[model samples]
Structures are given as structure tokens and as C-alpha cells.
Target: MKTSPRLESALKKLYTAFHSNKLNPECNKHCAVGNILDNTDIWKHLSDHHGSIKLNYIGTVHQRIGRKFNGYSPLELLEIEATFLKACGYQLPLHYKNTKPKNPTDKIILFKGLSDVIRILCEMDGIDNVMDYTKLFEVKNQKAFYDIV
Candidate 1:
């Protein structure tokens, strides 16, 4: 159950942001990757457009050099952002006229986005999805298998 230090740190920050109502998909400084990167907008420069998986010149250089920002590569960061945006109901390559959620700050909306990002994070760390609870519904020998503790 060991987690990477970088992943642990990012999860801690993201958890804090979620509960503090700081997670906002429309704001660069409050978005998923932004929170993981300490609410900094620097990661935005890694891509030419928001919600895009394509890396820019700087992002490509960093990825090619094997640089890690807050434990994620430049491309990984972009994927995280794109994943979050998509889960939040944003149109790809986010634009002012692009379709988006009616309420970007809604708890339900944010939760969905957070869930997807967490799955991606776990994948990046080669771990099981922490948010997955399907195991609780397992059935064994025609009996419900559950863990009470």
C-alpha cells in the first residue's frame, strides 16, 4: 500500500483543496493540476491551450529531459488537466464559447472531476484506484462478501 512521495503530496493538497472549496475547473490557479502543483499557474505554460494533452515547447523539453514537476511529467500534468476538464463537462481545448457545466463549482461536479483525476493519479503510480469501492460489493459462494472493519 506504499505510495510515492510525490503522489502522496499531490493527493494531500488536492484533498485539502476539495474540502476547502478551492477546487475550480475554470480557474487556472484552482484547477486540478494547479492544486497538485501548489496552486501555481506555471503549469499552464506547458500547453498552448487549456484542456489539451499536447505539450508545448517548454513542456516537451521538460518531458524529454525527464523532469518531474510535483512528481508529474509535463505530459502527465496535461493529461491530468484534460481529464479533470472532461469530467467537469468542459469541451476540449477549453474556450470561452466551449460547452461547460452549468455550475462549475458544484460539489457533485467537482467530485466527479476529482474522482477521475484520482484514478489517473493511481494509474500513474501503478496503484489501484483509491476511489474505487466495487470490491465492497463482491459476492462469494452466493453470499455477500463484506468487510465490516
Candidate 2:
């Protein structure tokens, strides 16, 4: 599939965010590391199964990972991610559960639950594909804040 320059630029930004480990801080503690580890295995499986499945939208990709764990509802997460993606200037493809395509090859994109706005931002920075699990730790450090009186 051909990717637009605007999309490519947005993806580059997303990649930076991912590479910088910015969004990992927000993942639920119990699930965060596990998800990252599982994702690596899943990526391997996907690569073997589908032979290099291209990620047009990283937020959507994460939503799939969220679905595999059975904690959060995938659809809800996808919606939240979609909202965030839109904020980052990427138009989300329509989502219809009942009419979802039957074949993986037929599907352009698939998003499950509420989207993580921050995660979407990270993806827009060009962080779609991840190789190592430890890299997620870099995103765990949250900045401290002081309130004005």
C-alpha cells in the first residue's frame, strides 16, 4: 500500500515518540511489561504468519495487543486511540464491528477499544515496530510537577 507524505511524516513523529519511550509510562503497571514482551513474541508470530504485516497505524496495532490480554475492552481502547490519532492529524478509518471484514487480507485497519491519546501521539512520532522488550522501560519515567498556589 502506498503511504502519503503527510502520513509518513506523522509516522516518523510517532516513531520518535515510541523510540523515546514516552508512552510506556501510561500502560497499566501489571500489563505494561507483559504486553511489551508479549508483543515481541506476537510480532514474531505475525511476521511468520502474515509475512511482514505493515502497520499503517500503530495505535490500531496496540489495540490488538490490548485485546489479546482480556483486561480492557478492545473497542473502547480503539476509540480512545482513534481520538488521539485524529488530534495528531491522522484520519481514522471507519470501525464497524458487526460488518468487520472476514479475511485479514481484506482488512485495511482494525481497532478494538478506547484509544490511548498519548499512545497515538507516540505512534504519530514514528514508533510503529518494536523489537526489544526492555526498550519499553525508557517510557516509564514520569516527570514530576509542581502546582502553583
Candidate 3:
């Protein structure tokens, strides 16, 4: 599926922001990621509906029928979801999940933007075709030091 122009624009902006990596001694990774997500309209629907990013993020991802990712923070969960989807070769807006991992690796590469992540998050609660939706993308040789991915 093609992303809406507004979503696309948000993704491009987020992509640019990600590359910029605002340098500040006080800034943390979660804040950096959250700030980018906060700046976009991707998660606005859920956030507003749930009254907070933390709640909407948790409810959407936790209630979803596909790959469910959660963390101590919304941004961390968003990163995990995006990284998992990108690893499976899913382009932005399209989706695949629930596939069995073949020799699952510890590494997950995240290349998509916040738009991609928001779509994935929104899909979790919808009715999914069990046959078509079961696909989990695996990664190559890389180790994750963090608990999220």
C-alpha cells in the first residue's frame, strides 16, 4: 500500500532528522527517538485517542494481531517494531508478520521511518489473515546489546 502524501512528508522529515542526530550532552536516545516521533503526525491519531503516547503505543502494539513489540518506553517499542518490519523486506505502508524465524539472529536493522512505524502500530489491532500475515523477517550476523531489539 502507498502511504498518504502527508505521511510520506512526515517520513521524509523524520528521515532527515534521524540523519541529523542533534548533538546535546543532555539528550538521551529515547528522547531523540521520541522527539522525532513526536514531531510527526504518524502516531498522532493513536496518541490523541489514548490521551498519551505511552498508552496509545502500548495499546496498539499490545492489542495487534501481528508482530507485537513493547518496551519500557514508546520510542523504544517504536524502534523495535520498525526494525523488525524492515528486516523482513517490507516497504513502507505494506506489512508482513507472524512468520517463523529461521535461525533467528540477535540483530535487527531499522531503515524505515516513523510513518512506516505508525502503520505497523496501527495494524496490530486489525483483523489479520492468518495465512498471509504470518511472516517474521530475520537479520544477519549482528548482536544486540539492548533489550528491546
Candidate 4:
């Protein structure tokens, strides 16, 4: 899958933001690896204030607010992804989805969606590899992370 330049730049910026020691004044003294995992208060603060929440590919943003709603269709996912790409300053190719080969050889053609976006975020943050994390968003046993490879 071809990634947009804007997405690449965003990934790089997120990587630097997460790994730069200078950004966290007390990182060495107080914030250890285990602290991030074990501390509930710290985790809550990160989720609530740090924009750490991830979007769902299957569900719209409103569904994230605990409202019962149907998941996005494949075409809707494409539209949403295009919006995200534009927001990140990238112009996606015209008829991007239609450009795919008519006779595809791959048995499992993974559709890039919001899950892929979160995977990129996780990768940039050095939190977890795609395999360890992407399973959480998998539907019907189709692994999004594995599909990337």
C-alpha cells in the first residue's frame, strides 16, 4: 500500500514528539515504562487530556461517545480515510480504490482504514508492534496488522 507524504510526515512528527526526552522534564525521574502501564490515574489523564483516544474504523465518531450506531460501510471507510488524508495535508489520488487490479492475486486483501491509521500512530509512538496491538480492532478474525505485511 502506498502511503501519502502527509501521513509519512505526520508519523515522523508523532515519533519525535513521543521519543524526545526534552519534551518531558521529569521523564527520567518519574515516568518509567511500568508507570505508564500500571498507573490508572496516569493512564486516565493520558486518555482524557492528551488526545490519546483512537478512532474506530467500523464505527463513526459518534459511536465513540457510547451511542449505538451501525458501523461504516467499505465505501464510507474510503470516504473517511480520504478526509483524514486531506486533514493531514495530503491529496489522495482520484478514483484511488478503483485503481486496484481487477484480478487480484492476494487471498487476503486488507482494506486500509482507520485501524491502519491507529497502527501508524502506535508505530510512531513506539508503544507496540502492529501484531501485538492490531488484534484489538480485528473483526471476524481478519487480522488488520497481519494484512499489512
The candidate that wins on TM-score is 1
lDDT of 4: 0.32
Sorted on lDDT, best first, the list reads: 1, 3, 2, 4
User: lDDT of model 3 at residue 59?
Assistant: 47
**Number of residue pairs clashing in candidate 3, backbone atoms closer than 3 angstroms, sequence gap of 3 or more or interchain:** 6
- Local distance difference test, each candidate: 0.93, 0.33, 0.36, 0.32
Off-target runs (Cα >4 Å) in candidate 3 are 23-149
Leading candidate by lDDT: 1
Q: What is the lDDT, from 0 to 100, of the residue 77 in candidate 3?
A: 44
* By TM-score: ranked, best first: 1, 3, 2, 4
> By the lDDT metric, which is better: model 1 or model 4?
1
Q: Locate the minimum summed-lDDT window of 10 residues in model 4.
A: 25-34
Candidate 3 on 22-117: residue-level lDDT in tens?
311112222223334444334333333211234365446644534322212344444433443344343433224434233222123233223345
* Backbone clashes under 3 angstroms, per model: 0, 31, 6, 0
Give candidate 2's whole-model lDDT.
0.33
Error of 4 at 61 (Å): 26
TM-score of each: 0.95, 0.24, 0.26, 0.21
Candidate 1 residue runs with Cα over 4 Å from true position = 144-146
Taking all chains together, the TM-score of candidate 2 against the true structure is 0.24
